[model samples]
Target: MNSVFTEDTKTGDIIIQFPAASKLFKEYKIDFCCGGNRPIGEVIKSQQLEDKDLIKVLNIMYEQMQTTEEIDWMTMPLTDLVNHIIHHYHAKTRDLLEELSAFVSKVYRVHGERDSHLKEVYTQFFLLKDELEQHLLGEEQRIFPKVMEYDLNNSLETLEEARAEINILEKEHEGAGDILKKIRQATNDYELPMDACNTYRLTYLKLEELESLTFDHIHLENNVLFRRL
Candidate 1:
């Protein structure tokens, strides 16, 4: 066992404490979202990965993460944090879903004949995109506003309503996460084929980016924002 990384460390806690660990987890095809609570040693054992190799990578990642820009969102004012989420994650995800849908369709029309799995990827992406669209709409139109109101004036009525909405949103988050997991599985963790076209390659890259962003988005909501209420 490497001294730099402990076996008892939770995968999600690793990523939460060191954002750079996310890249390492993705490289290892570790499910750091739904299965994030597992100990690193357990995950490594399940995935049949070498502990020494993972520890080496994590030590390097820890060093890099120290140099990266860190934001203390927990310290931010509630209103500012909410605004940032709306503008950064919600708006960005909406645009990405649109662009990804078009790109996935084109790739499926062209390269999917040769790679039957592309069809499955496209199907999963469609489901994910639709789910996200509705999820974002609910947050923007209903849930977020209520959260803001509850933050401003902590009334029992508003608190109960927000809690109920958060419960629903958390379930929706899980559903969206499941769809992304399916897409990732079908695409072999978004690895491009040797004969992949430019568009095919771009589609996979974009999908990976989308997954990373969504994970961060959900983490902020579930761990940070909702916990405050």
Candidate 2:
């Protein structure tokens, strides 16, 4: 069927042009990052997803983008956004993960008998922590550097390579998302049990914060930075 949204329009282009589309893509579990170059209509058809609902969400979000309180990363320079990811999200995540690691460990040790989910939470968090540390290192050492190079010189080859690395990074993001989901499920959406101690409460709160920050971090990179290429 012929749609108002052109078949050839790249999903990345759509999201980059309308940041709010990221939320819709997320709601639909569309891989806008790894498959960013694919045509939007093709993605929908290939996934057997209904295009009408997707188009409706995209339209609503595009309108909201005009007046949303969110930062319009589309207008911001790639380098500046990269710096924000590094200093604002990456660095903060590193520190938070470290503290959470110790906190979760202590809480599990102290309270695991009362609530068995703490053990799972403790295990999943460390997995996420390790994965995130490596993910951050990869971005800093390789991905971000290549992006900076492409930004400076506009090398098509470098851009292609960066896009490939971004696909891998997006898979990593999915893995991290799974771990966060497990934690949330185990903890009942970070809800404190009737007997949850101070440390237990703090651990759950911190995990929720980590989830929120990570979502924002992934959104900015996947939606804004990568689309420019």
Candidate 3:
């Protein structure tokens, strides 16, 4: 297989080929699980990321993987995994959501009339923000604690409790994902109008970030956590 990473390659395809891309995608907050069909350039531009920086990181990751072992999600301690998700993914996403919400609100206040989609996008963003806030709470309060208990005691009872919480979390994940799809459809995949200003572009970029974060959140809970339970 050719090891050269190409900018023209689809982000999801690259992830499928290079397992290391999964880690990079997680670092960049890029979606490779659900929303992995788009090209790397399109995903990067939509998120307003510096394409050169992303490519540089990808190349380095690819080179490093030649000698490095893939990360084993299952074998990692549950406490460490929970802490990692909370400190890295949840905390960063909460900050991003707050910033994006304010950005959308400003755009709506300033340009809602000129661009009607601003109001629509703003509403969708608020819905997603609220849902994610609650979702994170559930994980922190209910799911993560149970996982940690299981790790400490190695008890089937703790594992059972974790499984119960995970079921609810999975449903919430699906609901959030549905809302993201609606937002993408409403904005024509974050396509901006001809008269869009900087804030409009920022809103789309934030949506891309949210999309990526949500996928990572769900992937951790669904693929990694659930398997542990």
Candidate 4:
């Protein structure tokens, strides 16, 4: 059994192979979602991270994860996968977005004049929140049903619809990823200023949490579920 993940490995494929790999990728600030189709080496080179032992660490993490009892979405039934995406990612993310919206607004309103980036962060977040809310709804109402139906009956017609919907959703994922990145940049990776209050701190922290969750959400759909479809 080869336990090594080299630079040649596809970023998305790694997440499909080991969902837990997203944690390592997130920790390294490496993208394994929208750019998941690219090789790990491309990002490492572009980011000037060639000196880091990313491949070695990734291989080690993969080897370790093998010993743990984790749900392998790659081989799971499509219905099970869809349900997990809804329950695990969708429901929780909706709550998180709702929970953060007020704070995002407050932070921008109170501090926008003091720091221009706060305005950018505010604008980007609302854009993300709106886009994601619609995205989740689309998945639950449109594509996911087709996937579930195809899984149950293996209907060619349903499969065709699911494929088309998945393509559209993928493009939306790319756009959402771009907005999230812009927000991260505007917030300076969610660094709080010296005079920051509790609301400001909480806003930044939650926003960062949202970013992490969104990345994992996109990874599961793009790398794992969509491939199965």
Best TM-score among the predictions, by candidate number:
4
**For every model shown, what is its TM-score relative to the native structure?**
0.83, 0.73, 0.73, 0.95
Model 1's alpha-carbon lDDT is: 0.81
lDDT of 3 by residue, 1-229 (tens): 3446666777756664565677677666576654555778778888889645787677777776763465566678889989989998999889999898788899889888977776777888899899999989888998788889889999999888888876688778878888887888788877788987887798788888888777766766666667567
User: Poorest 10 consecutive residues of model 1 by lDDT?
Assistant: 59-68
- True-structure RMSD for candidate 2: 5.1
lDDT of 2 by residue, 135-203 (tens): 999999988988888878989998888888877888898788788879988987777878877887888
In model 2, the worst 10-residue window by lDDT is 1-10
TM-score of decoy 2: 0.73
Q: lDDT for model 4, on a 0 to 1 scale?
A: 0.87
Worst 10 residues of 3 by lDDT: 28-37
Q: How does each model score on lDDT?
A: 0.81, 0.79, 0.77, 0.87
Where does candidate 3 stray beyond 4 Å? 1-69
lDDT (Cα, 0-100) at 170 in candidate 3: 73
Winner by lDDT = 4
**Against the correct fold, how does model 3 do in TM-score?**
0.73
Order by lDDT, highest first: 4, 1, 2, 3
For candidate 1, the TM-score is: 0.83
Each candidate's root-mean-square deviation in Å? 3.0, 5.1, 7.0, 1.5
